[model samples]
Target: MSETDTDATATGTPDQRLHPWSWLFVLLQQLRQFIVPLLVLMFAGRGDHDAWPYAEYAEYAPLAGVLALVVVSVLQYFTYRYRIGAEGISIRSGLLQRNLREIPFTRIHNVGVHQSLLHRLFGVAEVRLESAGGNKPEGQMRVLGLQQALALEQLVRHHGSGAATTTGIAERPDGAAPAGQAEGRTLLSMPLGEVVRMGLVSNRGMLVVAAAAGLVAQASPERMMGNWLEQQVRGAAGYAEQLHLGWLGMASAALVLVAVAMAAIRLLSVALALSQYYGFRLIQTQGRLVVERGLFARLRTSVAPRRIQAWYQQETLLHRWFGRRALRIDTATGGGENDPRKLRELAPIATPAACEALFVHLLPGVQWPPAAWQGVPRRCWWRLFASSVPWTVLLVAVLWWHLGPWSLLAALWLPWSAYAAWQQAGRLGYVVDARLLAVRGGWWSRWWRMAELDKVQALQLQRSPLDRLLGTASLWLDTAGAGPLSPPLRIRFLPHAEARALHARLGRVLAARRMRW
Candidate 1:
């Protein structure tokens, strides 16, 4: 069923009140939290004969459970009120202490309606209201009939006027019409095909490795086997007493092969898990993006479009060959251990050109330059070369001393290191136009990022000892959201004077805009 249908029924009228069954559900949830401890107590007291130890606890169990259940039920009852006001929706909740959170009409990003298996069976659903404030989520309003969720969503949109606001800018203005409506645009959605495609393309290989690890731990064979292997290796190394060099070589080869296989299996399992967890629909609704994916426990994350601080596009050498790149957008909200809102990746990699086009379409006001800007100084090349050479020389010297003639293989590092340094130095570029500052960098996979000059939070110039000798400096541009900085974005190996010029220009732009950053 659709999300809207669930909310209406879940938020029953005041006179009607919550369904009596909801109390039971809340009680059960509270009890579930203590299930493990209860089981442990039961098992520990199974054969105990102390009258006060086990018998006294058992005697009080029923009363204690009832009191706890009642207290929680009452708390749940008061903690789960949803009301619609003329200005906005206010959800009053909290068990021990009370929390009254009001979602003003203007603050609402999107209204998310969802259903789990349990809710489905009961003809109910949960409703989530997302906002840009990045506050903790209030409890799910359980058993909302579908119609209510939809009505609330509609009501929010109707009240939230379509008037343009400066806060909603995702990209700098570029004279083109906004890609979608600012007040009420659907950002993303998934048909059944997209959902299934997401699932199928997931990397489930990692799950296998995790399962194997669990099995190995349960079997308790690692310690024994590892010790035995260690002894065999030591014996082999000192085998002049009894064994031949040929046997030692063969044993070592076998051991190395086994270790390699184990590592490969572990890596494969992790990849599989990532694929499974992240497989689902990423839809846009109003001011927020919704991500729904997971195998066992379904997750629905709502991220406000305006809260997105930065976008990162990454591609490994292999990914480039496959014509795919990974896109990551950072939002203000810090997603927790399993933060659903923090990262959204599009799998089935899109080509760099296609990815850039998609980004432009999603983020209004951002533009990709016709060609990458390349005004960086020549000193960047030498800076990169010098930084890498010292490390290369050290590694070569160490290997030559340690491995004799076999160490000649270390010579390969010099040329490869130089080539890598050149590639990295060549990739950095920056462009500043009337409305925005764009940075582009990457060797195998390129990143083209544009931010409104006004939105830059801070700018920093840094120079290492090597950078000083080369007369170059690194530039850092900070934004207001959560995400790591990138290279072209870093202004790495740019001449000191040029770096200051860019920094001053950015500062002047912010000042003209009256932006604190």
Candidate 2:
């Protein structure tokens, strides 16, 4: 049932190679993996450089690294071999051990297509075969003529259906498929303007900073940053004016640092977003929802609609100001570039109306904007206050101990915390209807989630010590799969009796329904 052409070979279809550009990819990947070790070796190989604080051969280190990468890439290109057949794929590689693997199409749950700028220049794409059962991809083709990639995808997807790809060629000689990027009917695509807005709202800057800090921490002492800051401060307040201008210099330095950090963060966030999320599109087909995105590294992931186990949409405070929300879906057979958890952004940034449309498309014949939502009990708010005030009070006390009167400003958090808790309580609610169950709640932006009874794996109604004191309970729903940020549906602070009733109702419904996988 695999997509295979009449052109036959006993070894399972003839061997295939990634596009010519694949050598560059191999080199980059190899360089990235070995960079740290290579650096360590470069430094170690100095062979005792106490005299100059550097290795005598350091000038050639970079050249040596480049040459090593070229050698590795050459070996990788010559050893890699993959064949596509009607039932599955066979991969053979490994210069020394001679590794071989045969992966069945049935075991693969996701097919991800990617095109970095290099591949695009060559009119080729990469295919990543993934299975929900593992953390790693089953196999991957570095580069294939774009059409061949699409045809191979078609062959695997419609193996049982006996359907041909758009061109009807199940297999093609490497790099021989015509010059077209495989694309499906576009279901939704963000406008460039919206893309820019989303880019502004993304927090890539913080991630970049965190990554840099982590690398620094790994490479040096933990106190290195503190010592560096002290040295800068000392240096900024020159020896002649150390006492007279110390405070002024420090204040100026602090302001400049803050301004620079903010500018860098904002600039990086926008640039990263623009580069990573340009030309984002979501397409719906007979059996798969194809998500295409990325500017430098274009990615296309195909997932089955039924594979979607749960979904939720949320808006960030920044996006909410512009009336945009992000939606994501969870799938049971989940793993790969499209694993709903990591890239919970199925719709990175779009209008609320767009989010609703996506919801309808994913779950038709289902009620949305849930008819009724009953909120948690008033004690929930009291619980919120009781839980928050102590932490805020302790924080204020700690700050006061360290900073004197200035610490009083920390108490400002108490009121703000209480206000936030109130807002959250207002948003938290539960809904139960014929076929669907939903929980609505969030802080900066409201979120509503729903799952069919058949999708629910388990239900729990339990009261914590605090809940028992408040005469309330928490209802937790365990769906078949986990989502990106949160799991199924969890409604805290439900009245005890109501929680029991809802649990029983869902339990009976789950028992009656025939679940799908």
lDDT of each: 0.57, 0.72
Candidate 1 C-alpha error for residue 421, in Å: 2.6
* Candidate 2 per-residue lDDT over residues 1-517, each given as its tens digit: 2232233345445676655667777787788888897888766665766656556777577678889789878877787777765567777776876677778767777787888787888888888887664566778777677877876766666642344233334334443433453545777798788888886787878889899988987888879988997997788667527556477776876698899988888778877887877888888654577777887878777777766767877777988888898887666654643443223457888988888887877778776777678888654665676777787778878988789989888888777777777888887887777867778877876677877666788788888897788678888887755744564488888788888888887777777775433
Which runs of model 2 end up more than 4 angstroms from their true locations? 1-15, 20-24, 48-79, 94-100, 121-123, 160-183, 213-224, 227-264, 333-343, 514-517
Q: What are the TM-scores, per candidate, against the unseen true structure?
A: 0.68, 0.81
- In the range 58-88, model 1's lDDT, one tens digit per residue, is 6455556667777878767755666655455
For this target, which candidate reaches the highest lDDT against the unseen true structure?
2
lDDT of 2 at 162: 45
Candidate 1, superposed: residue stretches over 4 Å from native = 1-36, 51-75, 94-99, 110-126, 130-135, 138-225, 228-304, 341-348, 375-415, 444-446, 464-466, 484-489, 515-517
lDDT for residue 349 in candidate 1, whole number 0-100: 46
Candidate 1 accuracy as TM-score: 0.68
Worst 10 residues of 2 by lDDT: 1-10
